[model samples]
Target: MEARTGREKQVYKKGSIRQVAGCVPVNKTTKKILLITRRKKKGGWMLPKGGWENDESEQEAAIRETYEEAGARGKVTSLIGVWDHNVINKKTGLPKATFSFFEMEVEKLEEKWPEMDERDRQWFAYEDALKVLIKPFMREVVEKCSLAPSNKRSKKEFSESNINKNLKDTWNLKFSAIVVFFAFLIWYLIKDNKFISILT
Candidate 1:
């Protein structure tokens, strides 16, 4: 006896899938993560990543994007994870995307590179980098990497809290300077007895 068939096959739309690759370049010795800022995005921050080329493998694409965006060349040590989520493409308004992330250790950092004008690269601690990341899932990935075992740990890692404190101190210093400048101006006028003359 043949059983009644009720199962249905799943079908994917043509040209609906997009592939991307990126890496998290971490300096374990310094406990710092490198990040890049896109020129078009203004204040937005992101990991170095891009779409795969037809002739390149996923890891190759990841390495190329890292170098292009951050001016850093390195080897992908391990596959962190493969993540997929919908993103509305600003140009096409489509929502199909996938990304493969890897753990990378920076080997050579060049003073000048292809994307020096298109992007700005900087280093931040795990927490501070997480704060500036534009994507939530990427933050998740960073958090996971921060917990992973490392062979070395540094004495000091840059912190956002420290940055805020430095800014506050700098403001106080500038304000103090201005106050002293006005105080000196008043003193000079009074010493020369010119203040009252000017008022008269």
Candidate 2:
């Protein structure tokens, strides 16, 4: 795999299936969610996840990805679900992709970030984090995290918060865009006919 600025290109063996793992770390006492901030890729706020290595169990792979990406340590508690999605590789036109999901509550939250590559790691309240997660499924998984055996928050609480945050973010983004558009229009009107010609 070649690492570029905010992108990674990985080469896999032909006809080989790839396995990936992720962790959904929820704080038991605070009912907050933990997420790692690595560089964004493909326009998504991705989780700390990666492919399985030689002879590594799926669970071990998941744990390793979590540590490497998030600087947190935990054990796989349960299977949230598996995602088998396909993407056409533009370079090869072959249906190249990965199948991945997460193992929930695999381990307890660590007090200190693990010594690894420098990545910003932080925990957000369930509502706040969902807004930043690029994947809808991630929001869904974190909302469900409170239902895990180790979670302290009630399921209903997380569900409501998740929904509310989704709505809030939607409206906020729309409103911001509208405001920017209007500001640009006013600027154009005040500037001259050249601005109008450019828009047209």
Candidate 3:
């Protein structure tokens, strides 16, 4: 998965405020992500997300939406990030709606769930999930958090760890190449020495 800074490129400052919580439910054991499709909408796929009432916390809202939309529940590993986009509210005015995303480790996939008739849920491989997602930022968030859910690390921490690991691997590769080059050089010197070959 690629790394992204998730810039707020389309945030609206005026009109009513809307808050939504979304979850990228993952199963590290199977390395799959849960995606949902609207009953009437075709082709496009999405993570479990919905607006929350004032009484619910962001985390609670996310979990609830996951169950209602995806029919799975588990621990929230991290607050992935927030994305804002400009949209027209009911009053026909522009508003910046915030979508707060989180990574959830799915513990179970129930046989029955709310909105089962209105939504279709399925597990998808990381790559396939990216292709089905309709929103670009949503895909970015998923890719950023697509690290194994068991790691339960924040996106920033995970990215830094990956950077360090990649750097170490690159250094080791370079060192190995140099060692192989020197070994071949020494072998060639001995093999091509006429006097040394005659003595052996």
In order, candidate lDDTs are 0.76, 0.62, 0.79
1-200 per-residue lDDT for model 1 (tens digits): 11112213211224555777888998878888999997654788889887776666889878877887788887788888888765666665665677888888988888987778777889888879889999898887786574343311321234656788999999999999999999999999999999989999
Model 2 residue 87 CA deviation in Å: 2.7
TM-score of each: 0.62, 0.54, 0.64
lDDT of 2 by residue, 1-200 (tens): 12112213332435533455677765656766677665542343546777766556667767766766666665566767665435666666655545455644524545444433455667777777778897776666665564444354556678889999999999999999999999998887768876667678
Best by lDDT: 3
The TM-score measured for candidate 2 stands at: 0.54
Give the better candidate number (1 or 2) by TM-score. Answer: 1
* Candidate 3: segments with Cα more than 4 A from true spot: 1-15, 86-94, 148-200
Pairing residues by index, what is the TM-score of model 3?
A: 0.64
In model 3, what lDDT does residue 75 have? 95
**Residue-level lDDT for 193 in candidate 1:** 94
lDDT per residue for candidate 3 within 1-200, as digits (tens), equals 11112323222234356677889999989888999997554667988887755566888889988888778979999999988764646575555578889999999888887778777888899888989998888888887785634344676788999999999999999999999999987788777895487668
The collision pairs in model 1 are none
Q: Select the stronger candidate by lDDT from 2 and 3.
A: 3
Q: Which candidate, 2 or 3, has the higher TM-score?
A: 3
